[model samples]
Target: MPSKIDPRRSGRSGGLRWPLVWNVAWRDLLSTLRDRRTLVSTILLPLLILPLFTLGMPLLLGRLIGGQAAERQKVGVVGTLPAELRRSLTRDESGRAGVELVSVTDPVEAVQSGEVEAALRAVTPLPTRAGEGSGQLELYAKLGNLKGQTGAQGKVESSVQAYNRALTLSRLEALGLDETALSPVTLRPVDASPAQEQRAGALAFLIPLMMLSFLLNGGMATALDSTAGEKERGTLESLLVSPVSRGEVVAGKLLATTLTSLATGVFSVLGFLAAGLAAAGLRGRSDVDAEMMQAMGGQLTLTPATLGAMVLIVLTVALLLSALLIALSIYARSYKEAQTYVTPLTFLIVFPAVALQFADFLTIGDALYALPVFGSMVAILDLVKGQITPLHTLLASGANLLGAGVLAWLAWRSFGREEVIFRN
Candidate 1:
């Protein structure tokens, strides 16, 4: 009898292995193309939604800022002040321009009507020590909205300061003191560094989060379809029957998924940049320069090294997410179950991404720097803040990549297990 051909040992060498990987990858890509609904949902959703959000956000913000600047702010004044003192309070002479001082019978009403950005309730002078007749006047306005309410507060503060100065001058005239009494203190505010100034923009935070969101969203869908969809449709079993190594199968699926995710991320970023630039350009009255946006985007480019780092970051995250989702989806009983499992993952990321935007406190301690998603967030923030120190970037990237690698390995291990691969 002729020796039986061992199919398992057939072509187990190097030449055919790569081709197998490519074939697997190609088949998955083609299958993806055939699913027009998924294709449209993944590709077109980001293409349309990202630009819409980016363009609309700036316009909304500009309207809010401009409306704030144009509003007639109400201010309350207390104490038995002469008409001259009140007139001086709201006039340009006192440097209190662009304010309308309304004498309020009720500070609550002023605030409630939104007539006042904030209300200033003045209290009587505090009792002074033995010889002093009176203490300085006390005033209060809303504190929470300090940035928005500052201009309105400044008007009130200046008016009080001016009145105090006039009172001092009257006393000096009565007692023969000089103007030198008013020169006690001065304040100087230094400007921030050029890098800090340059980094200030909506894009600083929005860009990175948008990049992350697109990656996760794209990766999740690809992972689910490749794993659960295949299992549910009984195609995965056929693929497993081929003379392909499990590693090659995984490698091919992972590569395709990462590419799909990366492409989505890139398109989203470009759309964001384009929509922002176009919106800025369309605003003829905006302080942002058209040429400046063009130059900033073109000349101050993310270098190839930085771009590579960013791509690596995105791909690593995508691969890990794809792998993890695939493992989960394999265990999921149905497509609806897989979708239900992944819904929380979407919201799970959203809060952290939003927190990353609002969180200003930074310890820079080693432990905080070592945390998983938070580290990525901190690194991206540092990158945006123009403080992408080489050591920090390397460390953060190393940690994230290491974690992703571990998770990917675990996913691959899960894929090889019959119990996981064929779970009900």
Candidate 2:
């Protein structure tokens, strides 16, 4: 009798076969690609949306809000501007600088009422002699407003900082003391990162989360469709009745899901690359807030080594998520039901990624490298900072692989169950 499965993707006879697994995976993948919309959303959405957000957003915001360049911001001052403050107030925070001082009867009320961008309330009269007395001022701006904080508050702070510096120097001169007395300890920051790390940027923190997000989103529809969708469509029984082993079928579906997830991650990395390039291109331009651009993402230089490391981390994540999602999807009788089981897992990946934003403030122990998703997150974050610690990377990837193995085993067990297979 002729074999029921392809010789290229399945063994003539099998007890857990790779060939059969690949065959099943390819079959499901082809089915998924037939849905042209999924193909486009999976491949093209990230490429288009990420660049639009990263690059286009600032330009959109600049024109809409008028704070990126030398556009003058309104800052209310309750008292007369000292000679020192007058020069400082001529500038904002980014680009060359621009600030328009507006005298207000009520500085705080002016800011709250939107009559001013920010307000500086003078508590003490402007000192004529720096050594004789001190000047006190209160700065007010809407704390919850992003534009106000980033644009107006930044300008006020810079002017006040400059004013403080000038006053300090004058006081030192009045006291007949050298500048050295002002600082018992001078801590100068030095850049110790490698040349390739020049573009590590603030957005590096998002790389780990980006990997998780793509892996989760990219593979989810495929995983649900492969398991629950097949079951709901009544095709799962036919596939099960075929000559292929249950483990082989599960392995195939898992592989298909992982590939889909990996594809999403690849596109996501491309988006990150695009955003980085856009930031670099805009960094030196005069029309935009170049300083803000650098601070936000700066130059995003992902070295070949970093890309390789990211691939390693993403692979482990895809595998783990694929197996887990497959297991959850297999337990549900309907596609919509599978979504209920799988939706919460999305939040599990997210909360950890959000917590990583404060990674700089936290102390990560060596044991964290052995965790599941968070471990991979840490490894990816290290790669983002241009810090390649091989042991941690290996540990995290190995842990994810180990977890994936267990989940894949559970999924294989589920496929073997008569009740599970026919659970509709």
Candidate 3:
């Protein structure tokens, strides 16, 4: 009998064959594109999430809070207020307070019932004798209603402070003392950060985390389907029996997945930019005025060089994650099992991405640039802040690519193993 030719053990090449790799990659890409689930995950989801977060939520919040500011607020007063104090509460130099002072027997109940935005209860009489205590004013606002708790309550507090200051001044003058003597020291705060840094601070964490999530989610469905989906459908064995080496097959699938991932990320960024442009245009109308347009323009400060660096970082990270996902999926015997493995991998990516938001990128040392996902996140943040150095970018990209190479090698090796490829 002649010895059988084992396709898996035959036609092995020490180096990658581009033609076979390209053929395999093209096929996988076509298959993934044909799948509706893959298209939705990699493309549509980012389109929805980016606008909802960056544009829709901000506009919604502004409307809610802005509406609250413009409306008249009701404040329940528990006791009869002095004529002078009542006049002060109703209006001042800034203008009339947009508040309705209602006399209520039960101030807290009025607040709880939403009849009042806040309540002021008299605790004690104003200070008179040395032993006597100063008058206490208790303000109550519903905690769940943020507008009431913050905006209305803040306005009431400001009025009370002004009243207290005036009263203190009167008492001191009656004693023939200067009002300035009461305040021995004054303090003021200065923000040292540049305007660009301040704007970047608002968006640094959000942009990077969004990009990381899109990069991972974009490739996950395709990665699992290419590996375990084919295995469960009985097509993986047929592919393995072909003349192509396992390395080339793995490389092809990796390329396809990387491309899908990259496309998702690119589409997400484009979607975000489109949404931002729309918002800018809306804010640039003649009614909005030049100051508003200038302010909106200042928030988006990406230069050509920064955009190029960001694209490079996104692509490299997508490649690294794609390989890892492929390797993990290869171990799964079925598509469902592969999904279970890939789900936890999302947490691994998400947690670090979220945590990096709170990280001070400026203070973080260069050693952290050696980490895979974390390094890429930091580099993206640095780029956003316009502080990324060439060396830092090189280190992060090198580490990420090195890790990807290792994962690709492992996946290729797994493809060559009979038990893994055909495991039940």
Q: Backbone collision count in every prediction?
A: 0, 3, 0
Give stretches of model 3 more than 4 Å off.
1-12, 88-97, 126-133, 143-145, 165-190, 275-300, 361-363
Each model's lDDT comes to 0.61, 0.78, 0.76
Candidate 1 wrongly placed segments (more than 4 Å): 1-16, 30-59, 73-81, 88-105, 109-187, 192-197, 201-207, 271-301, 346-373
Worst 10 residues of 1 by lDDT: 291-300
Worst 10 residues of 2 by lDDT: 2-11
By lDDT, who's the top model here?
A: 2
Tens-place lDDT per residue, model 2, 130-212, is: 66577788888888887776676877787677777777888888789877897879999987776435455566666677668
Candidate 1: residue pairs that collide:
none
lDDT of 1 by residue, 19-54 (tens): 887887777777776776757656776677766665
Model 3 TM-score on a 0 to 1 scale: 0.85
Q: What are the TM-scores, per candidate, against the unseen true structure?
A: 0.69, 0.81, 0.85
Backbone-clash count (model 1):
0
Q: What global local distance difference test value does model 3 have?
A: 0.76
Put down candidate 3 lDDT per residue, 286-334, tens digits, no spaces.
3323223333321334578877777878888999999999999999999
